[model samples]
Target chain A: MFWRKLLNIDSKIIYVVVGLALLLPVIKPVGMPVSISEEYTRRFYNYLTDIPKDAVVFFDLSFRETGEAELGSSVLPAFELLQKRGVKIVCGGQWQQAPFFMQSRLEKKAEEIGSVYGVDWVNIGYKPGGTATWRAMMEDFWKGAAGVDCNETKFDELPLMDRVRKLDKETFAAIVIWQAGTPGSGTWMQYAPDIPLLAVYMGGIGGNARYLRSGQVQAMIGGMQQAAEFEIITDCLGDATGLLDAQSLAVLVVIAFIVLGNISWIMVKRQDSLERSS
Target chain B: MNMDPLIMLEAVGTIAVLSYVWKENAAYRFFEFTAIGLVAAHSIVQTWNNYLKPTVRDRMIGDGEWYLLIPAAIGLLYYTRVMDKKFSWLARYPISISIGYSIGYSLAYSPRPFLKEFRNNFASFGHVNDYIFLLVWLLVVFYFIFTLMKKTKKTLRVTGAITRCLIMIYMGVLFGTSILGKFSRLLGRYQFLLRDWLRLI
Candidate 1:
């Protein structure tokens, strides 16, 4: 009976419980300690911190709107670190929707820092041709970037672009990729294999592991756990840390449900077996 | 209580989308359709502006790169698929070209990076962690070997069993991490609902 009750509970009830678990924390903050288990996040943080000012870095903001909640939180703090260091960034998007996210972040933080467009930073916007686009960018940077910045300004007009003509180790200091899926870090890895690449993956550790195993990605932050870790480590309080409470509460609720279900199932099975044997 | 129209729409959409967790209905369907339509429209506009405008339209006329027309012609051949049977084969030309290009590109580039990593796996085991990692990696690789004969040796069988167990453990860890990832994403939607739209937090 207990097993049946546990298994057949109304789905709506579960939804309401999970919803509240997420909601209550956001409304009233509980200062839950966020643990930093991933060593790579600290490595990534340190790597980004040590990069000299005026060192041009190509950042691929390839996360679309759907990934904003998870990946965006991590990027905001990382972008702040980059801005704080005065590291010149060449932002580009492999995904079409990525530009809006990148633009909004800059409008908020970069503008406050008095960072100038085209001089201090430039956005090449969406590059359509996946691997071929990266290869082409390597072949001829301006041609591959379509010879214009994200604003449709000619590369020749941008002061930063005057020094950088192609994608190579000598031209750029490093590549930081904030990616959700393919045509992102993978494309960058395949084309620009030699460049020191840092990737923040908002996905499964399985995929992230492969890139790490292959040494294709020099550093990585794979999930919001690491994102929260990065925010705490950087001392920049942002969305990822804010949402960690809800995330942990929801996860605990689900785990509790799972454990209860398993216990009830085991008790019911034992009762049935004893009855049959008797 | 947000009075902004954009916030209002977002709040409504978020609730509508989340409503599917209980049960699907008209509100969910309406929002879903609207989202799909918006995304399709956005993609179309972006593709035309970011891709087609510069590559096809501008390059042809403004740059005098008339030679780019060859690939454009090959691309047009893909439209032959919806045409009559005689023209359908024309589609294969572009498909084959793309496939060949992809294969050659992968062959020329992919191996070195992976091999570079594979070489690192063989470096001197300086630490206990390194040895354990190498052993687990080898066992996981062994789990995939499908050539075991019906009369395989007892040691091989035991090794295979151990390999399978290790792989299962690896998979379980990865699955657990994936659940955590999804939970974070779910929390993101809630953050938007409370912080951005409702302004309650």
Candidate 2:
């Protein structure tokens, strides 16, 4: 009866427990030690560190607002690191709302680091076209971007833009994409294979392991855990690090629920089978 | 408590959206529709202000690139799908062109990378991991050969079972990662609710 009752527990009860697990840590952080992975986060940092100072790098903010927390955390520290290295950044997006979140964050980080706009960084923002747009960018950057920055300022006006005439190896040092889904790093890997591609995926890092192993992707940071690890390594601790405790607790609660549910299910099944056999 | 209007509005919207998980209600429905409407409207405005407006202003008018209208007209043909039954086929022009161009483009560029990936699978045989990869790859491929499997069902039963297990493991890993992604997003909302809205953190 107890096993049957446990098996039949209301989903809302699980939800409440999970919710508390998430909330408690945020209210009072556990500051659980986060061990950084050499394969994902460290490789990502090493690649950024190795980027030659004052070289241009393209940042593809190819995620929606929903992905901001995970991908955006990675972007902040990456921006800081690149800025510290004196690398020029030119930002754009495949996802429409990508720039909406990223531009302000970049601007804020730039201000803190005393970096100038147009000269140091330029947001070309998002264009509606997808792969064709990327293909056009490979052929001619300014033309593909419709000759305007996010604010409708001409690319000719931005010093950084002058150097980024095309999105090829000669022009940009590397392409770092904060990817949520398709029309992302894969698009770059397919279209502009010549340029080095670094990816920060919101999730599904396992799916992309093949690309990294194949050397199609130079480096990758997978999901929020890696994002938090990145923050620690870069020494630019932010929301991801703060939220890690909550994330860990919530995951634990979920696993516990899964185990309990499975045990209850098995017990009920065994009891029913024994009765039927009799 | 954080009293910022924007943050307050976000909090309300977030709560409304999350409320659906508990029970379907008017607040959830209203907010859900609002989100859809807002995103659609934003997409339209962004496309106009960022892309179409500038192209028309600078390229077509200022730069005297009137020939650009030819492509624009073709793109507009997509809207014909909503017009009338008689002219719905007009949308097919743009659709065909897009599909044809994509296929041509993929054929031109995608093969090299795919070939590289395929070659890499067979490139290394030194490591134990490499042997495992190769064995699993072959087994999975052999399992999918429907006619061959049917012909030698008894002989290949063990191979098929092993391949199925490997595939299931792969799927489980994929599903696990997907769940982690959702959890991260949920944590993001929790962060917002605590730190941004309630200021509890």
Candidate 3:
């Protein structure tokens, strides 16, 4: 009778229990351990500190819709690092919603770090032609980006572009890009030859670890695990750390369920076989 | 309650995705379909912006190349399956080209990396840790070799059982990891609702 009752409870109850358990913690996060990688430190930021003040460093926002969780937290610290240093920034988009989303993230950090805009930074909106745009930016930042700014003010009017009218400034610093597949690491490497580029890919488009080791990308932070690590290293600085703790706990619970299920099923089968023999 | 209308909607949208953990119902499906539709529409627009407008448009009409029409024609072949059979053959044209180009690209790219991985696993480093890993690796590889034989031996059975157990453990870990990963997203969605939008906290 007990076994029969156990089998009879509606699956709905299970769903509600699991859902609430996962959801409640997220609303009220209990901070957990995060294991941030050394690669992100060395590859993306180590080369960045040397760039002189007011050197143009472009931040490429690569999130569209699906890749936000994996991409967002990983890039947060890097943005904070750039803002604190008082370096000039040129921001743009490779994904549609990315610019709008990152505008807020950058603005919040800028307030904290006291980085000035138009004087200290600017955002150039999206453009067509992935490879073509990279080539245009390399040859001329204004030709493809003409009459565009982070605010729709003409690109030429920006003070940051004043001395560097030709887009061929040798002193320009670096381009840090986040990638989610198309127009990925290959395109920029092919067209934009130098100016010290760094990239992070947050999705399965990385192909595999083997491709990453080929020097195509300077650095990479992938999946939720890496993002959690970044959050831990930065002392749970961003909101993403909440998700990490929830995920680790969820995994543990699921594993326990699967083992128990298999054991129960095996026991039932054994009892049935014994009864038939008797 | 505090800020922009769109931010509230985005927060609601996130909670809708998380609602699935409670039940398989209409809200989750709506969000899933909306996400899919938006992505598909966005991809089409992006392809036009990135590929069609700059390359084919400027060259086709502005420069009067006439050669751009060929690719344009091949691209239109996708609609042929609905109405006609003969035109369906055009689909092969792009597939063949894609396969050919990818083959060429990968051939040039894959050799060194492939050799490096192959050598890394097989070649012993002479360290204690390295030897232990190498021994397990070779044993696993050889255990798979037993599948080739029509008959089984006592020795093969032991190794086969060990390999099977290892595989099960690996699968269990992977399943657990996936569940945890998904729950993380659900948690984010729930947080957006409770703290950011509702401000109940």
Candidate 4:
């Protein structure tokens, strides 16, 4: 049968279906208990706590601030790990707004760690130099970025630049890359191979974050799940955990739809089979 | 006046974005365009303030460093596209340099780690944690290879099973992540509306 033609459904029905799919979960959660994957937690916490003090950590803010949904969760745990371990951070932003975006968080984070900006950590600011600049950063570490801190101070004056200036075989403990898709985790791996790349992002509103979760990445914060995990691990629940049930419920609703869709298809198939038998 | 305009803007902007589920029309288009425009403007302003004005312009004018003119001259070649047919070919130099640089840069980093990763996968044959994953990866690779020969239903079933398993895992993660992501953006808007606009939060 020509289903749409036979049924004569209104076009407005499409909107209703989508609206309900999203809204139903907001109203009522499936109340499913989520079990934390051990490997992820173990690795996430262990990978972080294992780093030694004064170990150079490269932090790349690949995405802008609005990306907090995806990246906000992932970056927190890594940041917590660094703060606790006293890792020396050499930070840079792939995005233009990175300095301003990162500055706000670091202001609080630096306070927590008793770390100073120019001494313990430094922001190299936006590198519009693109991949060419990134490659130079690998070879020279400062060819594309010789001068200027994130605060726009001369690089020679900054303490962090002392080590970075000597780029020969200098390796960071790991690189924290906050990517919101496109020129993201994949780009960092290709551009700078000096250290292990940790993928972070403010998740795209839909399916994009999952692309990082696959084994292609060594480990991931897993968007809000990652953020929630951090809160659980830290024993400090924030806005991320406050909304966890709501987020979990939303997934359950989508799964329900998939099940409903299959059931609908089977009913139609069974009815067709009955007609043929008759 | 009750709260900051930025907060109200966030709320209004968030709902405007989500309105796309009903149907993509003018409201969504307005928000979309606004976002693109804002990002472009921000990039330009930042580039000017951070790199061009401070470094390039400062160095160029300070010592009368004429050598800095080389990149500027090459960058100008991009505009030659609007001038003449003969001048259009000048653009190719910059385009070629971009392609050349990207490849040169990528080759410097990609080869070794990927080789190590490949070795890691190959080295793990019988380990419990990695064995199933390794097999699944191989099966997917085989299924995706277009020229592969499939002699029997058994071969097809194996590919189908692996593919199905991978897809199910993919969907579960995708659904969970995307939903939360959307909600966060929405919450950002609600925070704006209630806190900034209405002063009700």
Give candidates' CA RMSD values in order: 2.4, 1.9, 5.9, 4.6
lDDT of 2 at A4: 98
Ranking by DockQ: 2, 1, 4, 3
lDDT winner, 3 or 4:
4
Candidate 3, residue A110: how far the Cα is off, in Å: 4.6
> How well is each residue in A1-278 modelled by candidate 4, as lDDT tens digits?
44323244454664355445444433443444545546554455666677788788877877665565445545555666676667878878676665566677777877876778777888888877676667666676655674677677887787877878632325687776776656666655554444666665454323432223333445556555666666678665554554455555555665665676566667677778889999
Q: How many residue pairs collide in each prediction?
A: 0, 0, 3, 8
Better of 1 and 2 by DockQ: 2
TM-score of every prediction relative to native:
0.92, 0.95, 0.69, 0.80
lDDT by candidate, in order shown? 0.79, 0.86, 0.62, 0.63
Model 2 per-residue lDDT at B31 = 93
Write the residue-wise lDDT of candidate 3 on B35-121 in tens digits: 889878977875565446645555567678888788777767676666678667767777787678668755755464455445655
Best by DockQ: 2
Worst 10 residues of 4 chain A by lDDT: A204-213
Q: Candidate 1's residue-wise lDDT over B91-112, tens digit each?
A: 9999999999889988998887
Residue range B1-201, candidate 4, lDDT tens digits: 354567557666777876786678787899999999998997787677656775565667765777978887887888888888988999988888878876875687678556655665566455584676676777677766632455455767667666878867867666656556666555444443444576653
Q: Candidate 4 at residue A236, lDDT?
A: 50
Which TM-score value belongs to model 4? 0.80
**TM-score ranking of the models:** 2, 1, 4, 3
Q: Please list the residue runs of candidate 4 whose C-alpha ends up more than 4 Å from where it truly belongs after superposition.
A: A1-36, A74-77, A97-99, A111-114, A166-171, A201-219, A272-278, B23-27, B58-65, B146-148, B151-184, B187-201
lDDT of 1 at A172: 86
User: Any residue pairs clashing in model 4, and if so which?
Assistant: A67-A202, A70-A201, A70-A202, A70-A203, A71-A201, A71-A202, A73-A227, B11-B189
